[model samples]
Target: MTHPAAPARRRFLISALSACAVGGLTTSLTACATSTFPFIPDYYTFSQKQVQEAVQRKFPYQRTVSQVFEVALMHPVVGLLPDTNRVSVRLDARLASPFLQQPVNGVFTLSSQLEYDPQSRSVVLRAPNVENVSVDGDAQAYTQQINAAAAVLATQLLTNYPVYTFKPDQLQFAGVTYEPGTITVLTNGIRVQIVEK
Candidate 1:
């Protein structure tokens, strides 16, 4: 009787172990399927092109000379435990300088809200803060200056957009050129340097 019971217990143990192994495999695959792509912490750096495309989609023309606007992400946080993160985007812009041929460089206080969805592995950016500056300069020069300024502003805005499907080379914004494989973006608050590829 004892020998018969031992064999039954051994079979039960084997069945239990097999079931557990299958369950563990399923859980791991599920996590992988839901995980976001390019899991690198600084993946957003590669998103410059996508951001530019979204900006172009948002604004298609450059005919007026009212004020220039741009969007910049401040304190971007990514890779939180689950799939949520927060980032602040400031919209900085200036108007064409009445005295100078180009627009005055100044910081605007516009703010934006960013939300990420882990299940979908996607991020959504919304602009809710905006500040505008008026241009005061020579009429003809200001017109030209504003147009030039707008081109640069558009380029910068596009570079900072939060999506990942667009490319900067496609917009062809004036004054702002992307020298791929030659430009280096620094993290020490240094100005971008463009070199020959």
Candidate 2:
């Protein structure tokens, strides 16, 4: 014969198991939802290689000397100042002319302050100072001439090397809009933050 409380006990056990299963599934889904939403970045850092490639690709090579002299401008190695708001530049130039008896190489270093322009939406590096100059052997004949030529190339670099730039219309993505704002110069790179809401 069945016990008097047997059916009630069996029903209670079934209810407990169903409740446990539903609770576990609910917890898993909540975890998934939290993981996918609500994320914001504080800053962005561009690497040395990335900066090099961007500047090299975007910065146009310019000829400092023409009819009378022959010289070609190349990309520069750029670095950020650790404590100061400055950028260090080192440029390499080659004296290429079929008429020349020997090849000559020139290296130049420039230091300049970085500035942000609101109108054009570009970072304009100020006019750079020539920190040092070195040229291949027996350049005394062209020392004065080369210095002038080097200055021209340095100016071009200071004017063209852009840390960051974004047009007003191009800043929107995925329901969020990125408007250009303040900038900070880091030791190895730069940070461009989005405008505050």
What are the lDDT figures for the candidates, one per model? 0.35, 0.62
Task: Give the root-mean-square deviation of each candidate in angstroms.
Answer: 16.8, 12.7
Give residue 113's lDDT in candidate 1 (0 to 100): 40
lDDT of 1 by residue, 1-197 (tens): 35878888788766655665667753422222212221111112333334434433544232333343222222221211112122222333343333556544433333334433223333334443332323444334444444455445434453335443224432223444323221122322111222222
Residues 1-197 of candidate 2: C-alpha lDDT, one tens digit per residue: 76979888788666655565567753322222223332233334455565566556644365637454566557678777757667777777677544456767777777777666766666667777777778887664777767776677677656646755656544554677555455567776776555533
Q: How many clashes show up per model?
A: 5, 0
The TM-score values for the models, in the order shown, are 0.26, 0.60
lDDT of 2 at 38: 26
Best by lDDT: 2
